[model samples]
Target chain A: MEITPAHYTVLSAALFSIGVIGVLVRRNVIIIFMAIELMLNAVNINLVAHARYLENLAGQVFVVFVIAVAAAEAAVGLGILLAFFRNKETVNIDEMNIMRW
Target chain B: MAEAIAFYTLAVLILGLGVAVITTPKTVHSVVFLVLNFLCVAVLYVVLRAEFLAVIQVLVYAGGIVVLYLFVVMLVNLKRAPEAHEDPRRLARLGLALSGAVLLELAGIVVYSYGRVTPASAPAAAGPLTGAGNTEELGWLLYTDYLIPFEVASVLLLVAMVGAIVLARRES
Candidate 1:
């Protein structure tokens, strides 16, 4: 069987669904962050696949930007996680209700 | 035939590692699984003919972000697992239902789009870059059409670095 763009799309969608499930089901903040990264990777896969199928460079370019943004997000997010853990002493999201009304 | 085999193998590895990263009991183990997932994704990028992206994915994600996660996991030092405290309000069930709905919706969109649109032939304008190689074409576009966004990305990285340091620093 030949690998088509549709195959890539289907794979991307499955990966994305797993990421969504991870974000929703996981309690650990760090694990949730990893799930988010997985979602981003899925998007990158779709972008590059389409770029190849369409013979355009734009998709690859966008993937570059996505990677940069993801790097920044991970840094800031992990920093926040560190600060939160320091204060709360737990990584559970349910316990992070300091501002709850 | 070999390409299909490699693609399927990488896809399964990527998805399986992703699931492990989310569901693993220990955060440290989850971080390790995440590294493997990222590496598989980098390989997928290479298979898709984006060599530059594959390298960047490995360097920045597998190299940089996973380390940050590992450091935080070690520093946090959890006495009890995060999963011990279930909300007990059926929220997990609700989350599952919500995510299932989202997945169905996304699948519908993908199928609809694929059915409606036919793949177009490659445009004639990109002919010059076909011979330029992946990295060179990417670099040309990055420096030319995307110069402003490129500069902005650097600034964003700098700001993220400063912010992370400030947030992680000990209080005086």
Candidate 2:
């Protein structure tokens, strides 16, 4: 049997679900960040699959932009994480309540 | 037959590594699993015929981003595991339920789209990229149609670099 877009979509959904679970369940900020990356990967899979199915390059083009944004996000996020670690001496999400009113 | 086999194998590896990244107790181990997951995704990109994207996935994700994650993991040497300080009031079960709802909603959308939308007929004639190769086609489009966004992305990266440096620098 030939693989279809549905197959790719299902895989993307499953991977995205796992990423969601990771973000929700994990207390470590770094793990949550990694989960976000997984979610982005899942989205990229969907984009590329659709690009192939639709016979268009737009989806792939968008994926390039998505990757760029993800890189920027990681850089800024990890920097913030480093600063947070310096001050708090921890990476636990629950303990990061300085802004909580 | 080979495509099917390769696709399934890569899919399984990607999903399994994703789960391992999340469930692994040690942060460093999670990062390692994440690298494997990225590699599998890159392979999937190759299977999808996006050769350029596959290479970019490996270079940017596995090489650049993963190393950045490893650096942060090593720099932030936690005295205690982050999981130990879970607040009693934080409802883990509720979070799981909410995420399950989101998953179900997304799945429903996927099913609906597949069922309702008529699949577009595959292109019979080869597009412009048939002779120029995937990377060349991508570059031509990137420089022509998508030039504005491409430049914007560069600006965004520069800003992000400055912001990261400022954020990470110790206050004098």
C-alpha lDDT values of all predictions:
0.87, 0.91
- Candidate 2 lDDT over B29-100, as tens digits, reads 999999999999989988777899999999999999999999999999888878888788888888889889
Compared with the true structure, model 2 gives a TM-score of: 0.96
Q: Interface root mean square deviation of every model, in Å?
A: 1.9, 1.3
Candidate 2 overall Cα lDDT vs. reference? 0.91
Residues A1-101, candidate 2: write the lDDT tens digits: 77778889989999999999999988999999999999999999999988877778888999999999999999999999999999999999999999994
DockQ of all candidates, in order?
0.71, 0.77
The DockQ-based CAPRI class assigned to model 2 is medium
lDDT of 1 at B49: 76
Model 2, residue B6: distance off in Å is 1.6
* Residue B127 lDDT (model 2): 58
Weakest lDDT window of 10 consecutive positions for candidate 2 chain A: A49-58
TM-score of chain B of 2: 0.93
What is the alpha-carbon RMSD of candidate 2 to the true structure? 1.5
TM-scores of all candidate predictions against the true structure: 0.94, 0.96
Model 2, position B9, has a per-residue lDDT of 94
lDDT of 1 by residue, B118-137 (tens): 55642344454467799998
lDDT of 1: 0.87
